[model samples]
Target: MKILHLFNELKFSGAEIMYVSAAPLFQKLGCKLTVANTSLQLGEYTPAFKTAGYTIIHQYIPHALLRQWKMRKELIQLIKEGGYDVVHIHRSDLRWIMSYCAWRTRCKAVYTTHSVFRSHWYSYPLHFMQRWTAYHLFHCTFQTISDSVDANERNYYHTQTTLIYNWYGSTRFYPATKEEKKQTRLELNIPQDALVIISVGGCSHIKRHHDVIKAMPTILKKYPKAIYLHLGEGNTLEEEKVLAKSLNLNQNVRFYGNQKDVRNFLIASDIYVMPSKFEGISLTTIEAMACNIPAILYNVPGLRDFNKEKECALLIPESTEVLAKSIIELYENPKQQSTLIQNGKEFVDAYFNMEKNARKIFELYTKR
Candidate 1:
């Protein structure tokens, strides 16, 4: 089968990561795969696909209204000429437009909702339009892939949706030995004895990185050796840095803009922290768990599914004081730390195994 995957941007987001990881699996199953990324700048993962012998087509679509319309015309032309059997779209904004274009060509169109809930003010209107377009355009056989049953229901309760757990390639992100961790710390100039808390994601308000910085003072009261590493980059980086400096944590907090190899930093860290205001499902959290790093995340919908209190991780309300307390409690109790780490590794290995997830996704595509 020939498959074409569509994404709004080729950035280092969860949806883009999923496509990059799953592309090789499609090749292994003897299917031809092609990626159509609307962004002009192909992200770090684009070369990986090229190396794996998959074709990636970059469709430059400006955010301007007139330019987007032109891009849609070009997208339709590409779909017609490509002769793909399945056209799968990963982002919602592309869904309605792509579905309409696919209808013109009479191709099978499938969409996957990477985010579970809509937090934006325009989400409800966009979702309503998506549902309408799905029913009118295409073959009226629109299907969605969601991370959890709750997520599936939250987005497409009345539509056809399947729950497929998000996965991390274990080979890419795994726990390091003591020696490996020490070497990584030395390379990054991180103190070996310091309590390292690494948070990997874009510096967005939804990620609540500011909240993590707010809790830093409290965490330092107990573990003065604590250091917070903010990985990845976005618009909020400057504002967050300012906030950290104002809180007198500029020296303790390090912002590593964006690293291609995040596993090295993950291995050097003692804990992973995410105080997201909302999440569809978090790939960073799963990656940290795969590395056997216990996580301290806010009690949000998708996060709550993984970090059950007293189980694999420590879940706290979206308060800096509560997050500080959880971090201190975990740091003070070694037995609890060991248990959380062990449980986290086991849970991730069983459920978020990339191989298993790849097979399931292939099955979904091949099913009649």
Candidate 2:
């Protein structure tokens, strides 16, 4: 089968990573997979897609209505000429273009709504008009990454028929050996006795990287030798760095902006934490778990869905003192920490094995 996947940006987000990881699996199954990004921004994940040896097409569509129509024609022409059997969409923007093109070409359409989507007050009228009227595309298979996001989407957007969990590529995200960890840590100039914590997400208010930086002082009160590593880059990177400096955590916090081998940093770290205000089964959480790191996350919607609370992670509230104590507690309690690590590994192996989950997606593509 020939499949064409669409996205607004090819950035290092959950949806993009899932598409990049699954494309190879689909190809291995004797299917042709091509990626199309409509965003004007050439995203960071584009190189990763090229490295994986898949064709990537850029349409460069923004919010202009006339431009959208032109892009819709471009999508239809591409799908027809490529003889694509399925057009899978992972991004929300320009989705109407994807849907209309697929409908025109008679290609099976699939859309997976990642939870990063939220309606703005200014765009309510336009959104309401689309949702209430028959103008919105509905003749397609719909999916979401988590139950909570699925519920919210179904109530507001469209009905989702499947719940596909986010899966991490096993080749990149896996447990490191003793020697491998030692070498990675040594290269980073990190001391063996220091407590290393990793939090990866693009710098943004929603991701709450600043919250983690603020929580660092309290964490340092107990574990003074703690090192908090921040990964990912975005518009808010300067704000987070400024906040960290203001809180006197400049020494304790190391901000690495968008590393290609993020899994290496995950393997080098002792624990993974993400206090984001939102997510749809965050791909980082899955990758951290797959790398055998005990994850500590807030009890937000997406995290709550994945939490066995004490089993997979130390799922806590958005409190600095509580987060600090949880880190110290997880460190001191070897038995509990080991249990969390084992359980995380089990969870990743069972639910997030890339090959297994990608096969499920391939099956979805072959339907109808």
Candidate 3:
């Protein structure tokens, strides 16, 4: 079967990373996958997709209103000519156009909701119209990656969706040995005895990376050698860097932009921290848990879902003081940390296994 995965701008984000790790599993199910860059310009993570053994194609969809119709026509022609059986869309911006084109070409299309978003008052009318058109007219199906996303879609679109939980690369994201951890820290130029705190995923406003940075001063007071590893890059990266510098926390915070192997960083870290405003079940958080690192996530929609039992991770209020306190508390309490680690590892192993979830996605494709 031929499958085409569509993205607005391919980047080093959760959805992109999850697919890269799961693509081979899909291929194992006898599917040929093609990824299309629908934005005006290609993204930096394009090479990673190509490395995942996908045939890369460009179907530029301009943001201009007048140009979308022509681009939509070209996209329809491409889908038909490529003989794609499934067109899986991972972006929301131009989904209506993509779904319309996929339907016009008579291909089964599915849109995966990777995050829960709240529409503004003005966007409600357009959201309703476009969503109605996509679900009814285009016959496009929706798939949500988390319970929060599923609930949000049901509330907004009034539709039932395929709820497929997100997964991570279990083999690559497992715990590291003592020697491996020491060696990784040495290679990364981090002190062996220093406390390492990490937060992976794009540095976006909603990610609240700045919240973590703001908490660094308080954390530094407790553990002077505490180091913050900021992985992934986005619009708020420079602003975060400036914030760190302005507060004299630059020395403690290391901004290592997008990384290919974040597992090494996770393996080296003592605690995983993500103060995201929300998430669609963050792949990074699960990866950290799978790596046996206790997590401290903000009590938000997507992040809070991981704390259903309140045993796997420490879900605290979104406050700089609380975040700093939680990190210090987790670091000081090794027994508590160990409990979280064991429970988190088990939770991820039980639900976020790539092989299992990838098969579910493949079934969705084949069934259609």
Candidate 4:
């Protein structure tokens, strides 16, 4: 089977990583996998994809509507020339174009909605318009890959969508040894005695870095040696840094912008906390769980689906007081912490294995 995967950017994100991880598995199963991205720069994960023996196609086009139309025309030509069995689109903008192009080219198209929430308010109108185009103009056969039933239900009811869970890649991100943790901590200038709290996501308001900062005073009161590490980058970094300085948490808080090896950082941390206001399925949570780091996340739709309180993770209400209390409680009880960590690993291994999920997707593609 020949498959063409479409993405807007080749950035080191969950969607990009998922495609890179799954493409090799597909290739091993006697399938041809080709990747196309809007950006010429394939970002951090390009080397891994190249090493896996997959072809990368860069489609340079501006985000403007006219440019997108021309790009769609070019993409349709490519699909026709390649005679691909399937076209799978990961990003929303690309999904729209692929929907139209595939319909015109008489090719099967599949869309995976990685994120349930739009990144901006403008995206609302754009997505709604795309939905209209997909359903009416293109007569597109749509499917959604979601981590939670809430996301599934929302898409199904709102747009008559099909749903699947985003798979967790294999056990590459395991717990680090004492020596490894010590070396990583030293590199980051984190004290060995400190109770390290790591949050990995683009630094944005939706991820709620502000909420985490607000909870810190209370958390620090209990665990005086607490440290917060923010991983990844976004437009909000400077503002967050200013907020940290204002809160007098400059020493306790550190922002490691866009590290290539986040698995190392996850291994070095004592706990993984995600205070995001919204999500589809959090890859960072799965990575942390795989690393045997206990997770403390908001009891929101996507997060709550993965983390059962006192089971795999500690699910707290979306409040600074509640989050702080949970952090302190977890810090106080080492036995509970260990149990959560073990449970997290077990949960991910059982439900989120990438190879298994990719096989399911392969089956879907082969369906008549």
Clash number for each model: 0, 0, 0, 0
Query: Of the candidates numbered 2 and 4, which has the greater TM-score value?
Result: 2
- lDDT at 337 for candidate 1? 81
Which whole-number lDDT from 0 to 100 does residue 352 have in model 3?
84
lDDT of 3 at 337: 97
Residue-wise lDDT of candidate 1 within 62-89, one digit each (tens)? 6554465567777788888898777887
TM-score of candidate 2 on Cα atoms, chains taken together: 0.90
For residues 190-210, write the lDDT of model 2, one tens digit per residue. 888889999987788788887
How does model 4 fare in lDDT?
0.78
Q: How far does residue 283 in candidate 2 sit from its true spot (Å)?
A: 1.2
Tens digit per residue, CA lDDT, model 3, 1-368: 99999888888887888888888788888899899988788999999999999899987777654577767767888898999999998878666888888888889888888888778999778777877888889988888988889999898767668998999887788899999999999999999989899999887888989998999999888789999999988889999999999999877999999888899999999999988878888899999999999999888888888877658999899899999999998899999999999999888888888898888888888775
Cα distance off (Å), candidate 2, residue 314: 1.1
Residues 116-154, candidate 4, lDDT per residue (tens digit)? 554367566667777777766776656665556435535
lDDT of 3 at 232: 85
Q: Model 3: how large is the Cα RMSD against the reference?
A: 1.5
Worst 10-residue lDDT window, candidate 4: 149-158
Clashing pairs in 1: none
TM-score of 1: 0.89
Cand. 4 TM to true fold = 0.86
RMSD of each: 2.8, 2.6, 1.5, 3.2
Model 3 CA deviation exceeding 4 Å by range:
64-66
